[model samples]
Target: MKTFEARLKPLMIAGLDGEAQAWRAFLQLLRPALHAYFNRRQFQGDADVEDLVQDALLAIHAKRETWRRADPVTSWCFTIARYKLIDHLRKSGRAKLVPLVDDHVLLNDGVEDGAVRQDLAKLLEATPPRQRRLIEDVKLSGYSLAEAGERLGMTEGAAKVSLHRAMKTLMKRVADREH
Candidate 1:
């Protein structure tokens, strides 16, 4: 392990000159400690803590101007790295804290709405032009069948029949593809 003064002096001076070599030296000094810090504290599967450490070091390098030269380098480096680790924990869904409750409440939420919309878009791709137009007018755009009938120049019953048949055909096609 590199001694604190040996590790810090070069970086502090090189950082003054905004030299990349100083940035590299600083990261090498900090990485091992940051790794051990994360490993000892956070659970595994938090997206490779070493990567987070490197990210923190890079961020420190990028934001090096913010540091006061009078400040001790180790404290400044660890503080930045600690904040980065906390940020990673929050983003990775590992930092949430909820109150304990006696009553268990569960909701049966189905597939995500975004996923359903994507499936609908895919279904529309395979739909015939008339069916696609009718679905857009009635289901999607919220047009009444009577209005749709007038637009298609067909009777209300004929419009309903065509729309129903088109929906059934689409369902069958989607079902067949799934199977």
Candidate 2:
């Protein structure tokens, strides 16, 4: 019985060299290890674990070119897996694990209105001038996109694109802050 590294190295190299069969076999071999890795992390259910395994595998495949032959394949693979797990935890709103004893204390006070306004202003300040105005008019003022665009001297389509980009940037900033 060969060690996992011995078995995987050849397949990984072959896969990188564009061997279709070797690539398929490599993924098949990785699935069980990936499944076990996620299961040990106590994911919500088998479905979540399986989903993460697939995500890790896809990431590994996509980033294959970045892998150096001199590095331990397992380390590279697990790094990708760890990132996928973190992304899943963040997107699922489970990145932070609160203790049961602290639950009551955590719920004591809601966010202050002033704090929310300050945070909103901070996020808006990072946007470009045009996008800032579009966000303010369309979102904060509750104006229709067309109305906001008319007020800002832009077409409705332009306003929509600007707002979408601004919102995406804000979301990324918030996600980064959370992590």
Candidate 3:
């Protein structure tokens, strides 16, 4: 948000200029905002959320000098928060982070449908049948999560977890292939 650029940018600029008090103030203020960001994202627990907040804050501090003066401070801070979250998910051996791709991703891509479907089939081959169905319905077939869940007789939350696991399985297969 431009408001973040307006408010936090000055504090960061001052801190970069060797103004200790302003730097401390920036950290103090950024802490809560980062906390809220992690709290919303953390799937494990409160302690983990707190740990992630600390991690992001430390990363932000360590990289303060790299901040582009023209960029939004909040954007830079939240980028660190997102990476911390992805790292936590990876180290915890949980599912890969859900992608932010649009639901209609298949519609716009120029790739031929046959090739795409073949690739999708290969990637999804090892996934469980129900999970494969869920992935097809939600990710490829243009169904809402709730709709897919309903079709499969799963609760929405269960569907979400299942979809996450299916994607994780696909990612593992891809990684194994690359190696």
Candidate 4:
């Protein structure tokens, strides 16, 4: 009996060579492995696991030309599966990375704190005075939108729009700085 890798290698090679039947068979063979792969990682449910598997298979098919014959097919397939799993986690809003240190500890570090403050000040400076005040009151000061709006003498809806525009401007500035 052939090992799973051995069984998959020929099919992958054939699939890459444009054999439609071989590609279909390769995907079929990969389904169970993909399911098991996702299950072991504690995917939300069977449905989620199946969805991830199907996504992985489709990605594998689409990116087939990028796979090198010199590499083990299993490694290539699992790499795609891992990427799909990560994407699913991100899309589902479950990809947060917990910090090792507490917020208090981070704040006390004092390293580059001044620089960070200066950078933020510069970013905030790019916005108009009213939008900047709204962001500071609502986002930095942790006030509710309604409270911020009342404090700024504007309706909550107007405050929200101003904050959104301010945030968009700040994001563009940050992206520009990075480049």
Candidate 5:
């Protein structure tokens, strides 16, 4: 089964090589995840979220040549999205200073960004690679279970069951960590 990076990187390369279909497919695959990211961060309305997604896409298109072939495309795309989010927040005066961090943002979300990162990193490290990938692909990357399952060569039911178990395991691990 191919990892997300494994699957996405090639399409990105083909897009760079002027494959119009692959380029559109690559952006289409990314739209859901980028939309989810902005939605979770701020909620001006659906239009605002859509604006952010389009903004990120345009930025990605403009900066397409800057991406190093050896680096992770997802990381590069999210970096651009994050900057766009920060810019939006600043312009709206909702956030004066938003620190760039991983997994969680430094917002009014009660959980400190550092703590969220620590807990997330710990839980992710404890999960098996397949389960970890499921979590990342489905939950974080906004892919449906069926979509993620197809990528991993599993049935949707199997993917759903595995993700359920993964969440349970993380809950238990979090409880044990608290103890």
Candidate 6:
């Protein structure tokens, strides 16, 4: 796949820019390097790794203007990424070095549960756009019915109806999985 950076470089250079896309491209470019750094430093926990990556990306975007044009973008990105990783580790007290586990035990039953969760995520992704948005806003993100309705440009009653329908659909899908 052609990268966002590769596809959009000319536009960026011309100052006909996509700062958000540029940030996304920068994160994609930095992923491997960040992963290697975390692996080498023995960072554990999927949630921790994802949070660190997200925080680093946010900082990189915020500080993008400070990065020197003369310096290589990779180096600049890694520097910020590394600092973010270290900061998260320090704040969370999850930095203690432990002997690495080559293989971790997973309960045999967990495989089915994991598959169900994956399917649920996909099902949600495939949901009708408006209902999906409403469910995410009201249920997943804990937005109040009024708040969700306001954001979705609907009356609160309408939002509640839409959300109930969305949840019923999801429940039906999950229930069908058993059979």
lDDT of the candidates, in the order given: 0.64, 0.74, 0.73, 0.74, 0.77, 0.60
Reference-based TM-score of each model: 0.46, 0.54, 0.54, 0.52, 0.55, 0.41
Sort by lDDT, best first: what order?
5, 4, 2, 3, 1, 6
What ordering of candidates by TM-score runs from best to worst? 5, 3, 2, 4, 1, 6
* Candidate 6 or 5, higher lDDT: 5
Q: Which model scores highest in TM-score? A: 5
**Candidate 3 lDDT, 1-179, residue by residue in tens:** 34544667788999999999999998888888777666655466789888888888899899998878876566577666666777777787887553333233357541122233444667778788999999999987879989999999999999999999888878777666533
* Candidate 4 vs. true structure, TM-score: 0.52
Q: Least accurate stretch of 10 residues (summed lDDT) in model 5?
A: 106-115
Tell how far residue 132 is off in model 1, in angstroms.
72
Best by lDDT: 5
In model 1, how large is the Cα lDDT of residue 95? 42
Off by over 4 Å in 2: 96-178
Residue 68 displacement (Å), model 3: 1.2
TM-score of candidate 1 to 2 decimals: 0.46
User: Clashes in model 2: which pairs?
Assistant: none
Clashing residue pairs in candidate 6 (N, C-alpha, C atoms within 3 angstroms) = none
lDDT of 1: 0.64
